[model samples]
Target: MIEARQLTKRYGDKTAVDGVDFTVRPGAVTGFLGPNGAGKSTTMRMIIGLDAPTAGTVTVNGRRYAEHSAPLHEVGALLEARSIHPGRSAFDHLMVLAHTHGIGRARVTEVIEMTGLQAVARKRAGAFSLGMGQRLGIAAALLGDPQTIMLDEPVNGLDPEGVLWIRTLLTGLAAEGRTVFVSSHLMSEMALVADHLIVVGRGRVLADTTVQELVLQAGGDTVDVTTDDPAGLRRVLTGPGVEISGRPGSEQLSVTGLPARAIGLAAARHGIALFELTARTVSLEEAFMELTKDSVEYHAANTLVGAA
Candidate 1:
């Protein structure tokens, strides 16, 4: 498990991370989300002891990362995939890390196969493609078989196959009761893999909730119904906290603050014939935009300057 209590970081006069607190428990994939310049990298650095926190504390399994006797066995991290020596082969790189912690050659070989790096295991790191480098970094992370795994943009350089592979790997690891904390800008990918989320904005914690709950909070279920009596049905379904909207003079209505079942029941009781009734939940990307709209550091104009 990973826990942060009022964790903070500052450089010179700027505060990169404010007092943030959250717990990443085992057995689930917890996604870390934030816009650019939102202190996500700083916070992850602090967790792994790459950067010292100005205040508060972060711990892995009840101890700071540096305090662990076998740090690799406790936490596997992939902060920077290219932070490897260019002259060394993938096999040699894994061997070096394994040797540092008394891990045997068999484990190194195992990780190479596990990461699908066996074909290029003997190639120098500098000659590897971006995707292959990412695979090597992931191999190093899994070499220790740590209880906690932390990765920043693990899918950044991956192809579709590699992306799918990592997704399956992360979920599989979580199923085995390991703590998996990954930061990603891919909302669709996170929606598929993450069970929980920690969304930050401008150096502060903006949200800490389950993925489905956050989606519902940002935009409740929307129901679309095409009925013959649009006016009468609108009046019948209208209630406190309910919202109903439709195109001008159209028979279809969009509704919020109620479920489709309730709408169907109401329509039947009122003799409104419904041709279509569908419920839609907001996408994760939509929810992220809604929740972090004010926190985005940069905004692009919607219209193109040269467009007619």
Candidate 2:
């Protein structure tokens, strides 16, 4: 597991990361989410000892990364910026890293095969495509078979096949009780993989919760009800936190703050006939936008990138 306590970073007079605290547990995938310039990259750097924390501390597997005798075996990280020699072949790159920790050539070959780099293991890294390069980076991360794995924007240039492969690989790692912390802009994909989330904004931790809870907190769950007597059902269901709104001249009622079952029960009590009742939910992307709207450092004039 990875733990951060009041972690902070400063570069001269500017502060990149505030006093942020969060824990990434084992046996599940924990998603790290933030907008641009939210200090996410800085925080990740501190976790792996790429940068010294200005204050507080971060530890992987119950100890600081530097304190571990075999640091690679304790945690493996793949950041956005690639750390690779362009002239070397994928196989040579992994082999060189393996040699650092006394890892054997067999382990290097295993990661190469695991990352689907077997076909191009002998090819020079400079000649590899973006997706192929990403595969090589992932190969290095898995080289140690570490207990903790952290990745930032891992699917940046991956094709659909590579994307699916990563999804399966992460889940399999978590299934083995390993700590899997992934940061991605693909909310649709993270919704499917992450069991928990740590959302940050403005160099501060905004929320630490599950995917389901985050969605619910974004205006609760919505429901759709198409009834023959919209007015009658509306009269019975509309109360306190319940809301009923629909397009003009439409019989369907768009509901909020109430479960479909509860609405059905209320309608039944009022002897209202319903043709359809369906529960609608907010997506993870929608929730993220709602939670971080005020914390965004930059705004695009021509795009709704956060919402869409």
Question: What does each candidate score in C-alpha RMSD?
Answer: 2.4, 3.7
Top candidate on lDDT is 1
Candidate 1, lDDT over the whole model: 0.95
Best by TM-score: 1
lDDT of 2 by residue, 185-232 (tens): 899999999999999999999999999999988866899999988888
Clashing residue pairs, backbone N/CA/C < 3 A, model 1: none
Estimate the lDDT of model 2. Answer: 0.91
Compute the lDDT of residue 76 as modeled in candidate 1: 96
lDDT of 1 by residue, 1-308 (tens): 99999999999899999999999999999999999988999999999999999999999999999999999999999999999999999999999999999999999999999999989999999999999999999999999999999999999889999999999999999999999999999999999999999999999999999999999887678999999899999899989979999998899999989999999999999899999999998999999999999999877789988899
